[model samples]
Target: MEIPIYIFYALLSAIFAALVAIFGKIGLEGIDSTLATTIRAFIMFVFLLLVSAFQGKLKGGITSRQFAFIVLSGVAGALSWLFYFLALKTGTVKAVVAIDRTSVVFAIAFAWLLLGEEVTLRAFIGALLIVIGAILVSLK
Candidate 1:
């Protein structure tokens, strides 16, 4: 069976996210976590802006509702990063990241509630196991 391209993209995102934990922890050695996160966010903004421009995706035609949602999403993401960096500053990478990965479980629940998406039994089981695994990994 052919694998979906999205799976590959997801895997790549996981890899880079792992690197973020490692690198962010190291980079937090002498500076404040919030400062580090701000700098990192700036770099990310520039990189994504360049990529979007390169792909001709910089056109602005979104409605106010769409703009509001996008801004809210950005705010949520920024808060996530700020807290993540703060955690990484003092916590073990494995423990911090394992706890952070619980976002997947949250996403599942949120999707079902907010987006009216169906949660299958298999997916529920997977999310349950992920919670268990994260707890085990996060334990001292």
Candidate 2:
């Protein structure tokens, strides 16, 4: 059976996310968390722009609604990163990341409530397990 292309991308995302914590922790020493986050965001913006330009994918126009939602998402992402860096500054990366990953549970609930997506019993159970695991890992 062929796995979906998205699965590969998701795996890459996970790998890169782990790297972010390690690298960001090292980079945050003697730096403000907000400043570090801004620097990271700037780097991401430039890289994304270069990739989009290289791929000729920058010409598309977006609707106002699309623009609004995208901006909202960016803001939410920035806030998440800001708090994550703050947490990492004072906490162990393992515990911080484990707790941060509980966002998946929030995502599941939000998708079901806001997007009207179906939540299977199995998914709920899995989310519950994640919560338990995160708690276990977070405890010293």
Candidate 3:
């Protein structure tokens, strides 16, 4: 049996995301959370810029609508990082990450509501389980 390529990418993303929580917590110890987050975002921007340039992905022309949505997404992502870093700075990583992972449920709801994506019964049940698990894990 063959696994889809996206599953592999998703697994890698999960690993890196876990590392982000640990590393961000340690790095936030002496610095302001907002400053730490800003530095991290800059690093990410530079790294992604290099990667896109190397991959020849920087040549594509984006439509105005696409550009507008991308800008909105960037703003949303910045807010997410700001809050996440602040949470990591003040809270236990286990609890913080547990709550942060609930973004999966948010994404599902947004997809269904804004994108007209169908939420299958299985997917809905899985999302509910994730919320329950997050709450359990985040408990004191």
Model number with the top TM-score: 2
Which residue segments of model 3 deviate by more than 4 Å? none
lDDT of 3: 0.97
- Each candidate: RMSD to true structure? 0.8, 0.6, 0.7
Model 2 clashing residue pairs (backbone): none
In candidate 1, how many Å is residue 52 off? 1.1
Q: Report clashes for each candidate as comma-separated counts.
A: 0, 0, 0
What's model 1's overall lDDT?
0.97
Stretch of 10 with least lDDT, candidate 3: 22-31
Residues 1-140, candidate 2: write the lDDT tens digits: 99999999999999999999999999999999999999999999999999999999999999999999999999999999999999999999999999999999999999999999999999999999999999999999
Better of 2 and 3 by TM-score: 2
TM-score against native, each model: 0.97, 0.98, 0.97
Q: Per-residue lDDT tens digits of candidate 1, residues 1-140? A: 99999999999999999999999999999999999999999999999999999999988599999999999999999999999999999999999999999999999999999999999999999999999999999999
Task: Estimate the TM-score for candidate 2.
Answer: 0.98
